[model samples]
Target: MMFMMFSPYSFLFFSTYMLFMFSLFNITNFYYYWSVMELMMLLFMGLSYTLFVSSYSQLMVYFLIQTLSSFMLLVFYIYNLPSLLTMAFLMKLSMFPFFMWYINLIYKFPNFMLWLASTLHKLPPMLMIKLFSLELNTNILWLSIVLTVLFSGVMMLMVLDLRLLLVLSSIGNNSWFLLSQMVNMFVFLFFLVIYSFSLFFLLNSFKGMSKPSLVSSMSSNPYALTLWVLSISGMPPFPVFFGKMLVILSLLMTVDMNYFFMLFLVMNSLMVMGYLQSVMKYFIYIYSSNIHYMLKY
Candidate 1:
């Protein structure tokens, strides 16, 4: 589950990507013309993953097959080269600088497609990040994580739009990849899966709401929705709580820079508080409105 050194990580991602994409539409709504663009995006992304992985594997094998001296020399040269490949994969994942495009795209897509993009489309890029992060410089990685988490958290608090909030949340959640590096793969994957489920449940509950809907109308299933929100907020008893606990424990052991870890904790607390406030605001909206007004919308 960690790096999967012996397995073909590429094929696994390719398969998961296909399954998630296919699962988004049932027979009733599986129209070809309606989702032509999305289908094309999936096809292109899948093929790109296959090619990149295959080429990388071939290159590594070629290097390994060479004499030891030649292999070490090649490694030295490669190490000195710029990390363009890594940057490209991160761009595809919509991390940081590349993320604004994704934020804009989510608004144009339907909720179901949004779920697929937010969860499934993220698989290969995540695997690539995990694989590369092991070899990349730790200092650079830590700096990127700190910047992304703080910036995304602040932006999330400022947004009133539901879609933007979700997008920022996804970006903030992406920090779990960095956390995974500190602890173990299980913790990272646990957070990823639980967060995906939270998003899926939340989006599904928004079925009858308007575009740019207020957070107050997120769901009629208030209990379920609240649980999902709290879980994502890293509230206890949820898997996210365990994941964060593991990350914090690992961070304490492996890194001496406790202040950075403290920053992460503070930012997470603020993010969760903002989410609860939004939910409470929704409840107030419900109480203040008439039954006719609620039914009319």
Candidate 2:
């Protein structure tokens, strides 16, 4: 099961390496669209399993591809080369006006797969953001911030499923928190622990209730649902809540008041909405007459 889930990501890395190599020698178009960035990302996940063919060779190739693609994008942005470069960066980062691939990918993947992709694959973009922010003007930073928040907000509003909505909300929150620049290794490690625990609990509960021919057990199994929901929602007592709070505090300390406030409110509001929707849906399913119907063959 784990292998099946991670196969796409490895395959994607391999394919991205191939594409990057192709781009290096074929210099006709020095610039490419942001959509190419999205395609590279898609390919990375879609080809994740290819790593098994030759782990050492493939891993080296994957790293090289990632490095080259990243460098090219950086040069494009740093040189103030062209709008296409900025667009490519935006696409790579899954920002607005080029966010369709992100939404579609999340919808297609299972909750666990979605979490893996979002959390693990975010390193490149985060590195890029850190690099760019150090060199770019405040205007560019703010623009990137606005686009990320808006794109996430819109997707959260549109997605009906609880998992996908949470994923979207997480992306927005991650973007806003990252802009703060005060986030350190300890904070990231803590967030990882909390996120992993919550996701594990949720997946376990889902599996428990999804047993064949079993009626929806989430409501009757309030303890399980409550634990999962509270952890995921970043409610008090969970590491995520404290981590997120610190991130907001850091944002307040680093960025302007207005930008911090705007991002904080929007991201938190979406999270709250997603939590409420999840709770409501579970309750509805629990109380509905169709519960038995859903479970029956």
For all candidates, the clash counts are 1, 16
lDDT of 2 by residue, 1-297 (tens): 333434555645655645653453333333343334445555654554342322344444444545455666767765775555655555555665545556654444444445545554554355444433434444544566666666676555665565566567656655544554435545554565566666556655654312111124333465676667777777888666776777667666765677545864665666556666667765675557566777784
Query: Which candidate number has the best TM-score?
Result: 1
Q: Write the per-residue lDDT of candidate 1 for residues 1-40, one digit (tens) a residue.
A: 2122213644565465576455543323323322432443
Candidate 1 residue spans exceeding 4 A from truth: 1-41, 44-89, 132-134, 208-217, 255-258, 291-297
The alpha-carbon deviation from the true structure for residue 96 of candidate 1, after best TM-score superposition, in angstroms, is 2.8
Off by over 4 Å in 2: 1-72, 77-87, 131-134, 143-147, 154-158, 180-185, 208-222, 289-297
Candidate 2: Cα lDDT at 273: 64
lDDT of 1 at 145: 64
TM-score computed on alpha carbons, candidate 2: 0.63
Decoy 1 TM-score against native: 0.65
